[model samples]
Target: MKTSKIIIYDEPTVPEIQIKKLEKFLHDTFHADTEIRKNFFENREDEIFQEIATTRVFELKKPFSKHIPTKLEIQIEKENIDNSQNEEKILYDGFEFQKIISKFIPSNENDQEILNIIFTNKLTCTFDESDFRYHARALIGTNPAIISTTGIIEAPAKPKEYYLDLMVNFTKESAEKIKEKYKGEFLEYNDSRITEVVEGYLLQAVMYYETGEAFCEDRECRLYNAHWQKELLYTQSNKKLCKNHEESLRKIINHS
Candidate 1:
């Protein structure tokens, strides 16, 4: 493995992630020393909050033209309150947010071999020049990676029938009923299956940092890029990598 050690930062708001369990998962899977820390955003300088606020994406259809955030937005960033029940969804420019995080990392720990993975409730999206729009991403991989709990839930498409049923009569009461019909068909905010699903992302992040590839084309691989919730559920619950990835994993570990 390229990275000798991995340091994971916790996301306290979403306890379902089971970050501690994930720390163990990393050690067992990669044979790399894993360390867990408290929330990375806590006690950060005020300017960092201000900078983070600016990365918010207001227009999904447009390219990322840095948003000038309001005082309220900056305050909201500083507060970092639980957003589990938020009525309005907030999105951030993924790469820009990554840039801000890179700045906060200390020089000694900034090297390639000391990987840092940050878990956050924030939904991160990237602007696709080809599509000319932004799309939600669960993992933004690099030295200091971001694994978004919000993105894992919101990025993948829900059941087609569920959305189709929702479009027929979109009211609060009706939506509630529709959601009930497909309760177990897709992931909900507090789904117990979240921990297993997150393990897949952890694999992706570490592999991406070490191998320069974040995803696999194989459907059976945990590293497969899943666009739908069902695929995520199936691939993650299988709890096994494909033949090629398993081989690659071995080679990486052997070198380490």
Candidate 2:
């Protein structure tokens, strides 16, 4: 199997102060002992790169030639919430807990078979789709309940940062290589919390794909559309724009 380099870019448009604060928060929260670096353009003509964050390098194994593994199944055991008669505490208060529950290339209808390889902090040795199939069958044979979400909560709280974007650049071969190597065992062996990281990446990617824009300081702002008008008035903000400005901006955006 061949491996390829994948680069994921996160461009955030936050105020300088807020960006610094966020960087500090992430570093402290994750206990990541790395310094955040800013890239500035010297040319006065160019717009400054607002904010940039990169993911640690991930080497993916390819299982097939056409598609890359976009999702994974991992075991998530929630800590017991204290819902006693005296106390009703909400777990992870004020924090939206979103995760990439399961992601795969989806070779077949048997989504259940993929559950067997989902072990905690264990990375499976490299294998291909065929290997995943075999391992999945073995898992089903031993424990049939692995696929069922008996205690897992499907839809959890939404995160505070509702808008996100992700740009993943990788060759098809590299993605397949990653899947091939860790088909059934990727989540189990990897020590890092794969669920949260993957979810964040996916959220970013989806936001970028859907909106065709980057994150902004104003979380409420949507690219090329006036979010204020939409929220303030019950109409598409762009449509509600003043006739002259609307026509001029439309012409500029359309032509440019």
10 residues in a row with least lDDT, candidate 2: 48-57
Name the top lDDT candidate. 1
Q: List the global CA lDDT of all models.
A: 0.89, 0.22
**Candidate 2, which segments miss by more than 4 Å at Cα?**
1-13, 40-256
Candidate 2, residues 198-247, lDDT tens digits: the string is 22222222233223333333323322221221231222122233444334
Q: In model 2, what lDDT does residue 152 have?
A: 14
TM-score of candidate 2 against the unseen true structure: 0.15
Instruction: Compare the candidates by TM-score and give the number of the best one.
Output: 1
Model 1: per-residue lDDT, tens digit, 88-153?
568999999999999998899999889999988888999998989999999999979998888999
